[model samples]
Each structure stands twice: as C-alpha cells, then as structure tokens.
Target chain A: MKATPARDQETVDKWEVQLRKGCLELAILAALWEGKLYGLEILRQLESDSDLIVSEGTVYPLLSRLKVLGLVKSEWVESEAGHPRKYYALTPAGKKRALEMAGIWTRFSSSMGKLLAPLGKGNK
Target chain B: MTMADDVQQRDAQQSMEAYLGRLRRRLRGMNDEDAREIVEELRSHIRDKAAASGQVTASGVDAALAALGSPEELASQYLTDDLLARAEVSRSPVRILESLFRWASLSVAGFLVLLGSMVGYFLGVVFILVAALKSFHPRTAGVWVLPNGADDFNISVRLGFGSAPLEGREVLGWWIMPIGLAAGCALVMLTTRFAIWCVRQYRKSRALPRG
Candidate 1:
C-alpha cells in the first residue's frame, strides 16, 4: 500500500460513506428486483454482490419506510424451520421508480468515468 | 464436557433474552401491538442469523446481535421512521410534534424545525393569554407605546399588573383583544404549517446532514 495521511484517508472514508448512504435505497430495491426475500437474505445478497455493506439494523426501518411510500409491500410467510419470516417485494410503483433510478445512475456514472479518464491516464 | 456446553448454552439463551428485553423497553411509547410485532420480527431475525452460523455459543449469538447494532439504536431508528410515516398522513399538530421530537434526535435539521415550532406555539399561547387577560384588565391589558423607557422608547404588551407605567400611553384601547386573538391564532397556524412543510421535505431523506 502507498503511504497516505490518516486525515486524507478519513476524508475518503467519509465520501464513501456518503456515497453508500445515497445508494442504499437503490441497492435494497434492486435486491428485491429478483423476487421476495427476507431481511437476512437481502443482507446476504448485498454482501455477495457488492461491497456496499450496511449495518444490519438500518434495513428493516428502511423497508418500513418503503412500504409507507407505497414502493414496496411485505407479508408474513410461515417457515417450517423457525418463526415466520417477513418477505418484502417491490410494488408496481417501486419497480417503476427503480427503473428510473437505474437510468439516471447509468448516465451519471458514464459522465463521471469520462471526467476521470484524464486522471486514469496520468496514473499510468 | 456436556456440563460446560450446557452452561454455555444457558448463557447464550440468557444473553439473547436480555438483548430482546432491552429492545422491548426501548420500543415503549410506540403502540404496544406494533412494538411487540417489531420486537418479535427482530427476535426471529436474530435467531435465524445465529443459527446460520451453526453455533449456539454466547459469542455466536452476540455476533448476530452486534450485526444489528445496539438495541437502543435500532429501536430509535424504528421509532423515527414510524413517526415520520404517520406524520406524513396526519395533519394533527400533536402527532407532528411527536414525530419531530423523535427526528430531532438524529439530525440538526429536525432539531431546528422542532425548536421553531415550540417557539411559535409558545408565542401563540402568550398572544392568546394577552388577549384573554385583556377582558379582565381593560385598563392595562393592551399594547403599550412607551415613548421613553430607561434606555430607548419601548413598545410592549402588558397585562397591567400594578400601575400602567408612569408616562407610557396605552394604544389600541379595546381593539387589542381582537388583534391579539387574531395574531395568536395566526402564529399558531403559521408555525404548524411551517413545521409540517419542513417535515415533509426532510422525510424523503433520513440520512443525517453532513457531520
């Protein structure tokens, strides 16, 4: 690893945190783009697919909010193994919103990549 | 030994119960039914996560609990989120203020909105009081235009306790009652609306302001 100042690293960490906070909703919604899943399943999916780790505590409350906004709906499904699991699925409005967000994200990332192209070349 | 494993297993169960107990206590003030539902759901999640690890040890369960953060923290998040959702659909001042108080714990924006509402409501009450008290003390319970005070000329609202000020002129006569009542009601209404507007704007994003 290259030597870097701790303060610089802290600043980078803060920006990454900000980025993660903004994308968390999209990430959760995208995870449900497949099908209904329980809380732990969502967590595992995010962990396996991306480095966008979140404290597990934040997920359920967010799911509740999404429900309130009519973006998602949940149901209690009985399980043979243990207690019933609460499975959440995106609603029609949620799917529409996710598509719109994904479009915006695609354009924004390409723009950012183009802007950073010079930096990449300089590093080489 | 089997005995040691039994002790560890008992300890693990106790830890989980203790954690759930703390969570239940923190979830107070929310509807009992809703709070109980949340706690049970969380309880299930913890059990499932812990079981997935294939160990029943205290450390294993604790790890699962830790992944969910502290009981208080999770409870507060749930409370804030619930309050905000309710506040969105509700026009009740009491309910809105309750939600703002919950949000105030997390963000500077929320704290400021709550403060503004409190100050507005306080002033509204004071205005109504001044108006109501005017009927009782017509002589002094009106707006006073003191041309000169100990420092500068001061305009004040007084309830006329002992003496109407030595040289201060009482303005508005009987009109003060109507003015005070109207102004009081207006302040209360304006404050409520402003607070609700702020709540609506901030509700879309719950992340704390740049810290």
Candidate 2:
C-alpha cells in the first residue's frame, strides 16, 4: 500500500503556523534582550532586526505571556511628548532563559544547516 | 496645532478609540489589567506611528490599524498564547481548580477537562459544595446554656454539628443555630466571591508587567 503525501493549502498553512508559533517566543525574548520597548515597539524591532515578520496584534499577547512567566518585567514611564508607555525588559530569570535558548537555537540551526547543505548544493 | 489639524487629530483619535473599543470587546475573558495594558500600548503605538508619518489624521489612523490587523484576529492570538502558556505550566490541583472555576460555564473547557481524565474535578466540585454547605451548618463549641430539664433541649458543638432546645428560660447557649446559620451564609458568600477572586487573581498574576 502506497501512502500519498498531502501538500494541500490547509496542510501548508498548518505547518507555517506551527513554524511561526515555535519561533515567536524566541524572537520576542531576543528583542527584549537588547533594551526595553512597548508592545508595538517590540513588533517593529523584531520586524526590522530579524527575518521575523510578525503582526502587531500577536505581539501584545505574547508580551503578556512572557510577563506571566516572570521572564519579562514592564513599567510605565511618562513619555516626554505623550502619555506613559508600558516598556518591557528582561528579568534576571528572563536573561538566563534567553541565553540558554540562544545557545540551543544556535546548535539546532547549525545542525539543520549541515543537514540541508547537501540539498542546497544539489538544487544549484 | 492649527484648527484644521486639530479636527483631523480629533478624527484620528476618535477612530483609534473605536478600534481599541472593538479590541476590548473582543477580549472578553482576558484579565482587566492585561486588557488595559494592551489597549494603552496600542494607543501609544498608533499615536507614535501617526506622529512619525506627519500629523495625526484619520487616514494615518486607518493605516496604523490596518497594519495591526483585525480585532478578532488579535484577540485569537492572545487566546492562543494564553492557552499555550497555560498548557506548559504544571497543572497543580490549585491551578486546575482555578481553571475549572474560571471556565465552569464554558462547555468546551469542561469537555477538555473530562477528556483529560481528571476525576479530580468531580471531587473538587463535591469538596467545594460540601465545604460551603458545612459552613451553613450551625455548630457550637464551649458551654451552651439552656432551660433546665427541657427534654427537647440538647446542645452539642461536636464537629460543627449543633443541637438546640425549643424553649429554655436561662438560655446561655441558645444562640448557636442562628449564629451558625449566619456564619454559614457568610461562608457561602465568601466562598463564591473567593472563587471569582481566585480566577481573577490567577489571570492577573499570570502577567503583572512590573507596573
């Protein structure tokens, strides 16, 4: 019996969602590792600083999740030109977790690179 | 700012408020503090973007909102993130209890809990209800003074159970049942309010953002 590989739009979309879901937490943590930024600022920074293109809506909730986990802390400071903005920064725990995640990500990506190298050369 | 610019800014501000209001309505079960934080952040972001693009106007506000995506989509994102985080955390009995309390009205959560093979929910419900009812049960400790030789009158405070006489002259401890009933009612009210409070606190504690 032969099994057919399903490459339907639904399947592709599912895969993409999973992929995005996995990386989003990492992207958010890394963005905060540099400095404090509010919800939208974090989204813009992620978009500009990395290959991660995220919608503004998703970022706020993710920030809430991170804060819940105690990996991030936020405070409101009155802006010079406008109202107070909730700026988020990494906690000590968050910094350690981010560092650990970065290390794991590095190894995983490097291993994936090696695994995909042969395919990359053959496609050329 | 000129009058025309003021009108444009006001129009833009109104649009932004409407957008945020829509978002707030979409985030129904979300904790109030978190919702407020989300709203304020988005507001500032919109204003900042508008300023960067030169003067706040309805068009600028529209563009900023378009970039953010729809309110429903945004709410679903928050919900997905919340569920994922919740799944990751160790489901201690307390957390599970809180979750059940939080989603008691939602059939989906009840279904999921049942599917998760946790018989503890039944135990939790039974425990909560029994405990609450027990509070209303009048019991007395120490001396319960009552009418002498009253065959119908008996008083015991053993283990939250109480006995009382119908009539007594020098009734020293005749007040146990009424006091117990009152205490019980209070306990029931407090228990319900505590359950609600626990759910809110759980949600609030899930993200305190240091502010």
Candidate 3:
C-alpha cells in the first residue's frame, strides 16, 4: 500500500526530531571544547560551519543547566568595545563527556556502515 | 533643549531602563559579572538603535524596545545548546509531578492542622489519621470528599414568640464544582505546555549544527 503524503511527512519529521534530540548535547560540548566563546560568537561559528541555527532563549537555559551540572564554566570579560561579554568554556568533566560522546558516535557509525556494506558492494 | 526634546529623551531612557530591569530579573543566579556584562551589552544595543533612528522621540524608543522583543525571548536567543539540553533534562513530567504532589500535600496538611486547632483536639487527631490513610492510598480514597445530597441537612429553632427553620443550605453550589474542575484541568494543561516548550527548545538547540 502507498503511504499517504501526510504519513510520509510525519515519518520524516519524527526521524529529524529523534536525530536532533540525540545529538544536541554532544554538539554543544564539542563546540565548547574547542575554545571559550560568547553567545553571538558561537552562533556565528555554527552558521559558518553547518546548517544548525540556535536562538538565545534555548542557549541561556542550557548554559544554566550545564553550569549546575558542573560541565561548563563561564566568566565575564571586557570586550574591545568596552562592553562586558560572558564567555563559556568547557570544564574538565565536560571535556571527558565530549570525548565519550565522540567515541559512541564513531562506534555507532561503523556498525551502521557494516550493516550497509553488502548493499553498497552490490550497487558497485 | 526644547520641551519636546527633553520629554523624548526621558521617555527613551525610561524604556531602556524598564527593558534592562526585566532582563536582569530573568538572568538572576548567573555570575554577577556575567549578568552585568549582559546588561551593558543590551544597553549599548538600545543606545545604538536609538541613535541610528536619528530622532529620539517616544516612537523611536518604542521601536527600539520592539526590536529587542520580550526579555524572555531575547534571553532565549543568547542561550547555548548545553544550557538548552540541561533545561530539557530538568523539565521531566515526573519531576513536575513530584513537585506538585509535595506542594499539594503540604497545603492540605497545613489546612487540616489549622482547622483542627480552631475546632478541637479530637477533630485534629481524626483529621491527621484520615489524611495519613488517604495519602497512603490516594487512588482508592480520592483527594477530597463531597456531600452527596445537600437536602438532608436542616436546622429548626424556636425563639421568643417566633419559630424559624433553615433547610437545604448549600455549602458548595453546583457551579462551584465545574469551576474547581476547570481550574484543576487548567493547571495540568499549563504544566504540560511548559514541559513541551522545554522539549522543543532542547531539540532546536541540538539541531543547530556545531562549529
């Protein structure tokens, strides 16, 4: 039976939602691990590197939560323009977690690759 | 400065101050230095926007305020993905339910204690016992009891050269029942909405590709 358009769209949305939910924490930690950044700078970097876009509303609460968990630390530094900017850097614990998440991603990708290898070879 | 110009400047400063006040309240519990920096940055932005408009009128101030949006909305834009993930983790339904249950239990217990003190020791003891039993088996006992029929209770009295009788005094009207039910339903709806909002925020933050 042919799937209706609405059903197909719903399936796609569900997969996208699952993928986003699964990777959000890893992405955030990885970004911070590279270097400390203020909110706007992080957004700019993300825009330059990938398709991901985040709003300040989502970022602030997340930062508060991570700070509570001791995964990240933040400080205020004077900007060249004389305004103070809050800069966030990864804590040691956060760095460790980032490494662990990266390992998991690598293993999962490899497993999926193995499962799809026969199909890839057949196509070749 | 002309009278009109003075008024315009005052309005602009007032609007900026009000917006900053709101942002500060929302940013409570952050490092003091960080909070101050955020305030300064926002202040600078408002000043720049106002200057760019070239006319410091009430309308220009309003325009700058509108551009900033509500404090909550602006603050959300500045949040990092890690913060969003943390918010999602804490917004669990189980956590909310646990908090609600605790609050309800405390309120009910306090009410019962106050009633018992005003009435009598025996009544208070009885209430405590009943509350304990109900709490242990909330599903079986229900949260509250309602009189099945109001018509059965009555009072009759004879005074000097007169007789009076009162009957079917409604302690709670039928309309009150629906109102209470609506209030309870609203509370549940609000809690669910908040949880959903937290989840959506988390997903949005996560979906943003990392640098």
Please compute DockQ, using alpha carbons, for every candidate against the native two-chain complex.
0.28, 0.26, 0.19
The candidate, 1 or 3, that scores higher on TM-score is 1
Which 10-residue window in model 2 chain B sums to the lowest lDDT? B202-211
Q: Write the per-residue lDDT of candidate 1 for residues B42-83, one digit (tens) a residue.
A: 877887887786656778889889777788667767866776
Local error of candidate 1 at residue A95 (angstroms):
1.9
Give the Å shift of residue A93 in candidate 2: 0.9
Q: In candidate 2, which residue ranges exceed 4 Å CA deviation?
A: A1-10, B1-3, B26-31, B79-211
Q: Which ten residues in a row have the lowest lDDT in candidate 3 chain B?
A: B156-165
Best model number under DockQ: 1
The 0-to-1 C-alpha lDDT of every candidate, in the order given, reads 0.80, 0.64, 0.56
- For candidate 2, lDDT tens digit of each residue in B139-197? 33322445457455554323224453444332223353455445545544444344434
Q: How would you encode candidate 3's per-residue C-alpha lDDT over A43-107 as one tens digit per residue?
A: 45655664555443444455656766778887878766545666889999999988999999999
Ranking by TM-score: 1, 2, 3
| Candidate 3: regions farther than 4 A off | A1-3, A116-124, B1-211
lDDT of 3 by residue, B1-211 (tens): 8998998889888988998898787655445775676687567555644665565566776776775567755543333322334445675444443333322232343233333322333333333333344434333321223234664433211111222123223232233334434544454455445544543543454433222
Q: Which rank order by DockQ, best down to worst?
A: 1, 2, 3
Determine the C-alpha RMSD for candidate 2 after optimal superposition of all C-alphas. Answer: 11.4
TM-score of 2: 0.63
Clashes of each: 0, 4, 16
